[model samples]
Every structure is written in structure tokens, then in C-alpha cells.
Target: MLKTVRSVSIADYAKSGVLILPLLSSRKRKAEERRGKTVRKKGQERLLQGNEAIVEGALRAGCRFFAGYPITPATEISELLSVRLPKVDGTFIQMEDEIASLGAVIGASLAGVKSMTATSGPGFSLMQENLGFACIAEVPCVVVNVMRGGPSTGLPTSPSQSDVMQARWGTHGDHPMIVLCPSTIRECYDLTIKAFNLSEKYRNPVILLVDEVIAHMREKIILDGDKPIDIFTRVKPTVPPEWYIPYEDTPTGIPAMADFGEGYRYHVTGLTHDTRGFPTSRPDEVDAFIRRLFRKISQNFTDMQMGEVFQTEDAEVAVIAYGCVARSAKRAVIDARERGIRAGLLKLNTIWPFMRTQVEKILHTSGCVIVPEMNMGQISREVKRVNKGTAKVFTINKVDGTIITPQEILGKIREVC
Candidate 1:
């Protein structure tokens, strides 16, 4: 006997606290079948590219503007947005390069439209200047980097975790940034949506860390309209239009954004600014503005540390990984369990803000932590910093353009354990 999934109404989502929508409706009796089922009302479940998934997620998140240059493994995002944006009454533009792409996205975001841009490592390198500009200006937008090998076009078609550090501090100077790395294909679809929400809520740019392997790998993602997705619009000030100070916060660290045509004559600039959004050369004003910008993100660390734990309870060894490496680490944990190694996996959906407290809790119960990344060990250093000498932090780093396999991670675990 085949059991069918019950389709629920949109209002029912809030009432039951569980959203039952059609993803890919499966005929099988397995728990992991959600990714394979396609609910027709929401969207059909077919083979979707990672870049396309990002495009869909952005659109669903109320992103009305997209600007980007076509780059390897991430071109599909721009290609899809070019056709989809106009149909949805949104705007899409192909810029001269990644720098212009980010410039356009920031301008549109300032105009009260949720905007996004997609690129790979080389393009990402060029966009850093404008990324810094968006940070200083407190612009809300999403940037998806389908990461390939780095260090000046190291490997275009290959997957690499080389940009993990770049996503955090590449823009230079003192700034707080939110970076989310998706391990699963489903997360590619889901986290892209969340990226926009966080960007809008915090009034900062959110980077979607997509590696090349996950970006190109075709996955059967179940699209369901019934899923209760949080779409956060930019915070609007309750103060009167004339009385509104754009840079002033409302206790929640987020300053209300005034769009370009909103009649709120606020000025925004790359240089240090003040409460009225005007540039100031005063030392106190510059100091206050920079600190507030960092606090807007650092203060929300509680909301930003999104992660998944696999068999962490009573584990002696833990595997910490993110992005495509997480998928491999999951299998390694299972294999280690069968061998009586008591290995666990901490898969990070939020890579930035480092989640040091949560990691400390895990380290208190574990003997060793293994960090497997596709680069020359970026996150392992963070793991070490968080571990604080409580546990031995070992790293398995590979930058040969291929994903770190489960066997590779298992070998590292064996050596460390």
C-alpha cells in the first residue's frame, strides 16, 4: 500500500506549526525522500542546477533586482534571473564586470529593492572593492559566490574551499559580515532564500558560499509552496518622515533603511557617516559609525549561528565541516560509528561569526575535532581558536579542485583519533 502526502493550505502552516506542502511526492517509504518529491503546486521536482536553485531561492525571497556577470559554474544564476526578473516585474542587468554588478545591486538595494549578484572566485576578487563599499554604506543585498579554485583563476571548473576566509575578511578593514555555506543541494535552494532575509533584516550584504561541485551537481529538490519561509523586508522607521534619522537604531541594532524614492532625503556614502547618513570627517563620528556597523552583525550572533549536529551526543571525536565537504563528512561519521570510533559531525550552515560558544559546548564532550575543507585549511584555524586547546583539532585540506571524499576524511579521523 502506497501512502500519499496530505496537501495542506497556506494558512494551515501557522496553525499547526508545521508546513506540509508538496516537495517531490515520493511513492517510497523512506525519510530522506523529501528531496526527490516534486509538489506541482509549489514547483515541479526535476533536475535543477545549483545556480538555478539559487536563482529560484532569491526570487522566492522577494529579491526584485539582480545584476551580475556570467562566470564559470555560476552563470546559470544570472541567465535564469535575466528571464525571470522581468516576468515578475523585477529588474535584471548584465554589467560590464563583477565590480559593476555589485555596484548596481547596492544601488538597487538602496532604492528599496532586495537585490542580488552571483559570481565565482575570479569575479568575486574584482567585486571586493564594491563589497567593501556596501559594507561601509550598510547596504542590504545578497551575493552568491559559486566558489571555484582561487588565487587568481587557480581552477575555473574545479571545486575549492579556498574562498572561505575571503568571504569573511576579503573586503578589508573592520566590518561585520554574514557568510552562509550550504552543504546540501536542498540548502542551496533554502539558504539562498535565508541569505536575502538576513541581508534585509540586518541591512548588510549576505554571502551565499556555493562551491563548484554543489553548484554543478544536479539534485532533485522538492519545491513546496507550503513551507513557511521567513521573508524579511528592510526595517522601516516608525519615526515621522521628517524626523527619521536613517542611521539611528531601534534597540535591535538594525537601523531603518530609507529607500531612494521614499521622500526621506538621506545621504549614503562610502566614507564614514553619521546618524543622518551624511559623511563626516569628525573622529568621534567615524569611530561611532564603524563600531555600530560591526555591532549590527556581531550583536546578532545568536540568530546567525545556524548549524546541524550528527550523532554528537557522547561522541569522542567530532568532524567539523561545511559546504560540499559536509556531505562527505556525514558519510565519514557513519563509517566511523560502524568502526566504534564514536565520531560525530558538526555541519555549519552559517560559516561566519564562527559560533565559538556552540563549538565550545561540543568540545567539552569530545576528545578530538577533525576539520575537512576543500582548501589549505581555513576553517580549521577557527576550529582551533574555538577549541582553545580543549580538543585536538586536526585538518584534512585539499585544493586540487576536487571535493574531499568520505574516505579521505575517514583517514584523517583515524590518524587524529
Candidate 2:
């Protein structure tokens, strides 16, 4: 015998205060069986931990080389890829340390392989110099930072969003990179794919930021079986090998990348370089090179920005959040709506490039914007900067290795409303 409930109410579930296991109907059971087959055959639906999903997503995105050091809250990604990459004829190397891990990934990417490395806060900090090198050299690779507490190995197993600012500016010098934050297991998978795509498309490093909560949480995800994921490979140089200039300017501010041993031999160094890839001390050449790197990302801001809006069409109070904290803000928004508060949520999927246009619009239209982060006001500072006195910006932050609850966000909404 099988049974099904049409829907479950949050109120009822809260009143019960215990986990309820659902009974599936016969039709639902058969559908689930079909999904299981689809998952096995086409690799669509499955219960995946966030870190595991990232590995699958990277492989699907054509990540043929992985070089990473073991770091908690992210080591599982390297562990899984170590076994899986060989089966796909890809290469995986466990480097001696995070610096070596990113260094190896940068080398792999320049050799024309789509590559990645994963780490947590401490390891992420260790990779900064190499990360900057990859950026200045315009090598495409993905970096996954499953954030745990830190300024110095604060908490390993616990979740934190303390690395939000670091992801944007950990590396020294002026450079451009993309950083995406995922709040759910599904986004953990999908954004990993997106991170690689952006890195390839833009010829720069891309950071996928997830906290311990999302990285360790397991969830059922229904991957699309009918449609295949779109993967983007870096644009190869069209010039003849004799005339090929690795850093030649293009309309998109992205140069056509030439792979090593691909009939093109070009120099790559961290120094400011010219079109021919030689270190340039010339003021004009250095200025142009730096601007081009910044322009590639700044000019294509529309393409880089990704976010979600809920109940904001007529909201007077908006909640701006990202990472696992966004999950609580979403629930708080829903509860606020039920209580007749015109509240809404602006969930940032792409944290860097900072959704300025969207944030500006919210600042102008809404009476107040609430920012709740797991860190001590990292993103809230950005929100306030964009607000510029147009609207009130309230911050509710926590960094005690604990997640902010829905009730806490709701309370802030109530206060502001």
C-alpha cells in the first residue's frame, strides 16, 4: 500500500516539531523508480553532498586536470576527484600544499587543460600569491573555497562566511576574477559548472564560495536529463603560429589563448606584459595591460551578474543575502509576508561584481535593505556602499561558527518594518 499528502504546511510541521517522513503514492513511487533509472543511465537525479556535487559538475564541465591539497570542509572534493578523474582519463594530483596546488592548476590550465583546485579558508589564504599569478597571466582555472572559520585556522568542521572579502581581494595588486557563492547543494553543482564556464569564457580564475553548512549538507537534486549542460572552451588563437601573439587585444578584452605545444610558443609571466607576452616596463604598455584585464570583467558586468529576487516586486523592505545565510533570509521573507509585511529577498548567486545595479535599484525603491551574513558585515559593507544614503541598510551578522536562524532575520525585518 502507498499513500501521499498533497502538501505539507510549515505551520503544521513546526507545531509537530519532529521530522515527518512522507509516504509516497504508488504513482510517485513509480516515478521515483523511473528517476532512479534516469539517474543511473543519464546521471540526473541523486542525493549528493555539496562537495560531491561540485566534483561531478567540474567533470561535466570538462575539468581534465585537478591539483589540490587536503583541507577540511573541502578535502572531500579532492578525494572524490582523485578516484573519478582517472576513470575519465583526466589527471588528478594531490600537491604538497595549497600554494603548490594552485601553482600546478595554473600550469595545467596554460597547457590547455581545464583545471581546478579546492580548499578552505587557511588553505585558500596560502594560495593567494599563486592565485594572483594566475590572474595576471590570464590563465583560466576554477578555485572552490568551502569556507570554514578563520583568520588563522579558527574552526575546521564548522561553517562560516568569513572568507567573503578574501575571495574578492585576497591576492595583492589590481586584477579581476569572478566569485560565485552557492547556498544549496544544487547550486553547489550548477555554480561549479558556471564557474568553469566563466573562467574559460573570460580567461581568468573563478572562485566558487561555499560555507561548511552547504558543503557538508546532503540533498536530493533532480538534474536535467533531457537537456545537456553547455560547456565553454577557451577561444583558441586564430593567427598563424608565426604571427600569433598570446596577449593580443580583442574586442571583448579577452585574448585568444594559445595552448602549449599547439604550434604556438609564447611566454607567460606574472609581470605586466605586452601583446607579445614579454615583460614590459613601458608605462603605456603596462597601463594598457592592466586596464584590459579590468575592462574584460567590468564591461561585461551584465553577463557576470546572477541573482534571484523573491516577493520584491512590491516590497518596501528587502533582505540582501548570500551563501547559506540566504536560506534563512528566504524563510524570514516568507514569514514576513504572511504577517502582512511587504518584505522581499535579493539572493546573490554571483557575489563579486557585487550586483551593483540590482542593489542600487533596491536601495532606491525599498525603504530599507537588510543584510545578514555569517561574517561580521563583509557584504553589508558593499550593500551600504551601494545604498549611498538612498535607503536604510541594516546588518545582522554572526560569526560564532553558527548559522543565523530564520527567526533572527524575521526579528530584524519586524524592527525595520
Give the C-alpha miss distance for residue 163 in model 1, angstroms. Answer: 0.6
lDDT of each: 0.82, 0.86
User: Highest TM-score, which number?
Assistant: 2
Off by over 4 Å in 1: 1-43, 226-228
TM-score of 1: 0.89
What's the distance in Å from true for residue 388, model 1?
1.8
Error of 2 at 386 (Å): 1.0
lDDT of 2 by residue, 1-417 (tens): 001112223564232212223446667656876776332222345778889989988988999999999889898998999999999999999989999999999999999999999999999999999999999999999999999988898987698999988999999998887999888777887889999999999998999999998898887776555456788999998879999878987788999999998989889999889989999999999999999999999999888788877678788999988888888887888788789999888888899978999888888889799999988999999988877799999999898899999999999999988
Residue 158, candidate 2: how far off, in angstroms? 1.3
Pairs of residues clashing in candidate 1: 23-37, 23-39, 24-37, 24-38, 25-37, 25-38
How does model 1 fare in lDDT?
0.82
